[model samples]
Every structure is written in structure tokens, then in C-alpha cells.
Target: MSVVTGCASCGDERAAGAAFCESCGRTLATGTPPAAGADCPACGTTDAVGADGYCGHCGRLVVRPRDHAETAVATVAAAVTDRGLRHHRNEDAMWLAARDADVDAVVCDGVSASFDPDIASEVAVEAAGRVLASGVPADSPGGLAARVGAAIAVAGAAVAALASTGDPRRAASNPACTIVAACVRGREIGYGWVGDSRAYWIPDEGDAEQLTEDDSWAAHAIGLGIDPRAAAVDPRAHAITAWLGADAGPVEPHTATLRPEQPGLLVLCSDGLWNYLSDPVEFAATVRGAVRKESDLLRAARALTALANERGGADNITVVLVPIN
Candidate 1:
């Protein structure tokens, strides 16, 4: 077992388990263990540990693992809202599920303006998860993107079927949403997306690089030499030219293989989260620091959302982060 050790003089990491750093000669602090009757391991908890090995908070079975790998947890958190200063209900949605040791992960962002945008987004995320678990083809150069596009097509058909139930809103309003998904099989990372919802590769203390671009007029303006900052902030930022839905054409996701040569972080978020980040450097720094702030990926993501809210919370917030260890 590794012991937590920090310098007494400057509160810096010394030798991991040493009483003092060999270089600085500063004393270190040890870690505190969980107290007896601590919260259960599963479901969730805050009350006393239960006698039934079930979480008193949620009554789900709890099991403390003996290995670190077995204990590694992946989670996701999101904050959805209508237009920052207007609108009644939030239509955006997102979820993080690390189904198998980070082998697969999915992040979905629903479009608030569409008919049943929320449902379309949720189904897409779940569908992506199912596709990855089924051993998606990763050998061919563009196979990953093709497979995702195919699966999204299937999900689109399902959405069409659901629409036929005759709720005019779901049937006629034209539901749609953007998505960015990542699947890690062994060390090969397959990612695919369409629309503005983004995927970022953050390796260590480096910058947060956007892996996808928005299919919006502002983006087109940016491409045409208009200042990105000024154009991105223009009031017409809500116009989206691409997304997934029943009427949306054959979904062809932007796909790529990512293998971080150096250990780092990955983030998948909607335009809502990125829109408020005024400075790219600060943006990357804030996201990178998130890794050190929380024990679980999900909590770190939630903290990121809170940071955005604290800054102004001008729009919906959604983020999913994955650490490559």
C-alpha cells in the first residue's frame, strides 16, 4: 500500500512514503484512514455503516475492494439549464458510465430546442455504450467512425419508431442533439462526434485541445477571418447546422484514434461549458487542475461545472472527464 506523504515546510509532495523528502529534507504528513461505521461502498451513504453490507443511504450492496484497480471508479456529473437568463426548463442532458475499467465511456448532450431532445440524447449515449461493449471494429483506419455512424443511424431509426406513438411534439417537432463518445479498448482509443459537442485531449499540464468543431454560423464566420471571440459570442450562437435526429441525414461522426504518448486527461463537453471559458490557457489550466481536486472523475467534472456557474453560469453546463493512468 502507498502512504500519503507531503512536506511539512511547504506542504509539497515529498517521497511518497518517506517521513521527509530526500531533496528538501521537509517532513511529510501521513494519510487518514476511513473511520469505523463509515459510509457503505455501494449505492451511496452518509449515515452509519449498516449491518447488512447494504448502503444505509441507498440500500445498494457494498463491497470494498482489496486492489487499487478494482477500486478505480469512473463517474460523471452534469448541470443543465434553459437559456441562462431565460427559459423555464433545462433540455440539455449528459451522463458518464465507465462500464469496464475505462474500456468504454459515453457522453451525450441533448438539444433543448428540439421536440424530445432530451430523450434522443439519452438514447444516443446508451446506444454508444452498447455498441462499444459489443466489440466494435477498430482495425481499419476509419472503421471506428463508420461503426459509430452506423450505430447512430440505428438509434435514429429507433427514435423514429418512438415518434410514431403520435405525440405531436415528439412526432413533428424534430428532436435532435450532439454527442462526443470515447471507447478505450486496451490502449487504443476510439472517439467520434458530430456537431459542436467536443472531445478534448489534455495530456498532463498541457493545453486543452478541442477535437471537434461546431457546425454553426459563428464557426463559419471564424473560418472566414471574423474574430473567433467576437463571432462566438454574438447572440446568434444557438444556431446549429448539424446534429442527430430522425430527419437528420445519415450520421457520419468525426472519428479518430487517440493514444496519449504521455499520461493525461480527456474531456467531452457541450458548447455550453466551453462558451464561458474566455481564455484558452485558463480554460485548460482549470480543467487540468480538476484532476487533482477530486478522488473520482465524476466529482472533478462536477467541480468544473460549479466553477463555470460561479463565473456566471450563462448557459447549460455539461462535462465528462476521463483520466488516462
Candidate 2:
């Protein structure tokens, strides 16, 4: 067992067997325990310490899923969304649904500046995921572009509707979030995005390319002839100009399509994962390395999240991976 030398709250020297500060009654941030202690958070007893990170006394998890979570949609698709090391709670959300050769995925990042941003992300992701999973239009003239556009439109409407009642808590700022949704049907891929969440096509060889353009101030400035590195490192680099919310006038998603020559991986992720590895070449190499280490998409997803955290995860991290067969 590791010892906590001092209580950060009261600056009092900690005594053995004490879980909380004697002076302030504040719980100690004892860091992660190498072994499960006899003290159980739920039952407050020493007889229920389980090695599985759960309370044997009350069947409660000492660690919650909100801290970290993972989902495996299929053998070829998986995703991981994490609260990250610095964030208190995860505001990013992701959904992946696969049917035969079709894979639908959505990732939303809550705008921290807005009220109830987490709610916005959840609402937007769910709305978009539902629409995408409803199946593509087989005979529609719009094809993949129309399908993706429709899903994003529905998601924007869902977010806009949240302000109809106007909760007092959010009077200053309505809930807002950025979205990136995509559908992979056989070899064809269609993607759409609002704000900074991005989609990338990483092949087994050649180069990887970003599919969606960011709807942010920095990206806009770069489009106007600013230096790429200079624009990305500017103070307002992440100030998103487009988002889904009541205050946002309109949610217009930039859409794209890609048909890769070689089968590889399609990565849909929030900025949290790519912020650390913004270089396309480096990002592609890291992704390929992770895949080579673990063929399973679930494991590869975990590896990418782990890499983000290792590089100092300052934001909620979300990643969704779809393997092209």
C-alpha cells in the first residue's frame, strides 16, 4: 500500500488507516491503489475488497464506467470514449452500428463554453446515430451524400429543439456540440461534419487523408491564405464557428466521399485524439502501428485512446474505428 504523506486540503500529515482528512473531512486523493484495499467505498467495510475493482459487499464498482468506457460494434468496428486524465467527466460521445457491409458511426464533442454541453453531445449523437442506422436510401438520387446530409440535419434539429423550453440554468448559453457522422457501405464512404470533429481515411499503404474540413475559426483563417502551422497554433485556433445549438443560426455540415484503392481503416474521432498528433503522417503511422499490434478493432481503439492519454489528454477523447474489408 502506498502512503499519502499529506492531505492537500488541510495540509495535515496523514495518519495510517485514515481514508479522509481528520481536520477537514475531505476525501483524500490517494491516487490509484496497486492492490484492492479492504476498505470498500459502498459498504464502508474491510471484508469486501475485490480484485475485480468492485465492492464485494454491495456489488458496486469502485471505479465507474463514466471514467472510461469501450464498445465493440463488430469484429471490424469498435470505439472508445474516455474522460481523459485531466477532465473531470467525459463530455464526448460516440455511437457505432454495423450491418453487413454497412457501418454507421457518429462522434460528438461538447463545447465546454456552453451550458450542459454533455447533454448536447449525448442528444446529438443519439439523434444522428438513430438516423444513420435507419439504413441508407437505396434508390435515392442523392445517394451517400444525401443520406449523410439527412442524418446531420436531423441531429441539428434535435439539438435546436433543446432550447424550446429554455431552461433557466442555460439562459446564458445553450447546450452546444460538434458532430462528425459517417456511413461506410462496402468500398464507398460518405462523411459529414459540423465544427471540429473529423474523419480520416488511413490506408495500409500510401498516405492518409482527412475527409472532413473543420468548421472552426482557425481552419477558416487557413483557407484565407494563413500558414497552416500558424493558424493551428493561434489563440483562437479551436474557436468553432459552426455547431448544433439553439443559439447557432444554422447547422450546415460539410460533406465528403472517398473510395480508397486499398482496404485499411476509417477513423472517426473527436479533436481530443488528434490534437496531440495533428500531423497526418504521424497520425497515420501511429494508427497503423496500433493496428499491427492488435488486429481486433476493439484493442486498436483502446491503444489509440491510451496513446492520447499518454500524450496528456487535456480534453475528452473519443475514437471510432471501421475496418474496410
Candidate 3:
């Protein structure tokens, strides 16, 4: 099988599975990730800002550690990095933490081409998380759809408003980004995403399959009869047709709930991390090893990043690891 290699952020082709691009220390095939943001969980009413990793209201830590007695231990790990191999600075950003999995998560990949792309990503992640936390109104079929539609429109509008504002990161044109968020509560799971960043759930015991498809030009080409292998090789594969921001053309998204109960590990990541670690078996092995090392959830996040970095830190890699028992 062909391996994954090259600078996902810059699109430099190289050896398959090669660690870092010889041209640059940048881990190839890995894309830029969103940066961490303030925790704005809806359920977290405590004065503790969820973003600070604690409960301001209760004056207690917000992130609950692994307590054998408190339900099954749910482990979450993640890391974000940007070296700006070519650019003056890295604009990618990411948020990975337990904001009440039941409440869901928010991930946004901003467009580096635009000014303050990082801020755009931050705005998107926070908006999605807050919306997911706020209770969706009680609705029937039409009501539910209409409510969701309105919420999405409002999200777009909110993003636009930020673009107009003069935040240090904001510019005449707002950066574009792609976001994917998933909510897991017990056996029930709901997911939503705008742009191409993805969400994947691979059973700890069963098979590994990607739950989301890329919204990239190459992915679209594959749907039109081109071979995925050839499509992958296309130089234009790097060209993302959609995302969030001023340059982002439209705002279409994917939303759904899992059928039958899903019991396994939940993986959410930016294109950077997924590009190099696409194999389901390998992905599972990495997570399992991290847990076995007696490492906490945070360690689990570091272990994976370490692996990528060891291989040759290529691109900005970011991941959220959630263990569902």
C-alpha cells in the first residue's frame, strides 16, 4: 500500500510515510491545526472560565480526572503546533479538551491565506461549542430542521460580524476555516461539521473506517469517477474547495446522529494529524499504547504527537482522543 508523505500545509510531494520533509523540518502530510480557545461550555455555569481548564464559578477544576468510580474512565488527549516553515508565522489553531463530551466539541481550521486566520478558527470553535451547549429548542421534524438551519445561518452571521470587527487578528478580509464537532453522551452521539476537517469513530474491538469524507477538490473528483490513488497524487488535491471565512465560498455542513449505539474510541482531528496517521489499526495502537503507559488523558494526547514528531515533525498536528467504554 502507498504511504502518506509531504507537507500537507504546503503540498510538497515526497517519499511515502516519510517523517519530515527533507526540504523543511515540517512534518510532511500533516496540516495546520486550530489553536486552543477559552472553554465556553453551556453546562459549565460555574464562574470558572471553561477555557482556563477550570471552573471559575465553583472554584474547582473543571476537567474531571480519571476516577475509577465516576462512570467509566474517559481519556482525552491532544496537541497543536505550528513552525511556519515558510510563512512569517503560523496561523493554525486548535481546541482539544473534555468540554463535557455530552455537550459536544468544536473544531475549526482557519485559512492561512487570510489575515488573522488563527482568530477565525478560534471564533468558529467557540461558536460551535457554545451553540451545541445551548439547548436546541424542542422541535418536531420540520421544527428541528428549521431550528438547525437558523442556527447555522446565525453561526455564519456571527463569523461575518467578527470579520468586520477590528481584532488584532481581524483584517479587511477574514480568514477561512473548516470545522467538525461531535457530541458523545453514553451510547448516543450527534455530529456536525462545516468545511472538511473530520470526525472518526473506530471500535476498539472492530474495524476502522472514517465516518466523514473530505470536502476537498480531490475527494470530489473521486466521486466523479477518478481513482482515489490518482486523485491523491494530483497537485490540486491540496486545494480545499470550501471552509469558513471571507474566502470560503458557501457554508454547507454535515450533521447526523449515530444509528444503533456506538461503543468504542472517538477520534477528532485536523487534516494535519490525520494525513500521516490514517491507518485505523495504527491509530488504535497509538491510543492503546498511550493508555497502557500509565499516562493520563493529557499524556495520551502527547504520545501521538511524540510519534509524529519522532518520525519527523512535518506539519502542524492536532488531535482529540476520547476513550468510550
Give the candidate number with the greatest lDDT: 2
TM-score for each of the candidates: 0.67, 0.80, 0.65
For model 1, residues 66-164, the per-residue Cα lDDT tens digits are 000011233322222222222232344443334344444455556677787666765675565455545556665466655555555555565545566
Clashes of each: 0, 0, 23
Candidates sorted by TM-score, descending order? Answer: 2, 1, 3
Question: What are the runs in model 3 whose C-alpha is more than 4 Å off?
Answer: 1-90, 95-103, 137-155, 166-173, 259-262, 293-295
Runs off by more than 4 Å, candidate 1: 1-90, 95-100, 140-143, 160-162
Q: Predictions ranked by lDDT, top down? A: 2, 1, 3
List the candidate 2 regions with Cα displacement exceeding 4 Å: 1-64
Global lDDT of each model? 0.57, 0.77, 0.54
C-alpha displacement of 56 in model 3, angstroms?
35
- Against the true structure, what is every candidate's RMSD? 13.6, 13.1, 15.9
Residues 190-279 of candidate 3: C-alpha lDDT, one tens digit per residue: 666666677777675666657777778888999999998899889988677767775455677666665334466677776656666666
Question: Given candidate 2, what's the lDDT at residue 47?
Answer: 57
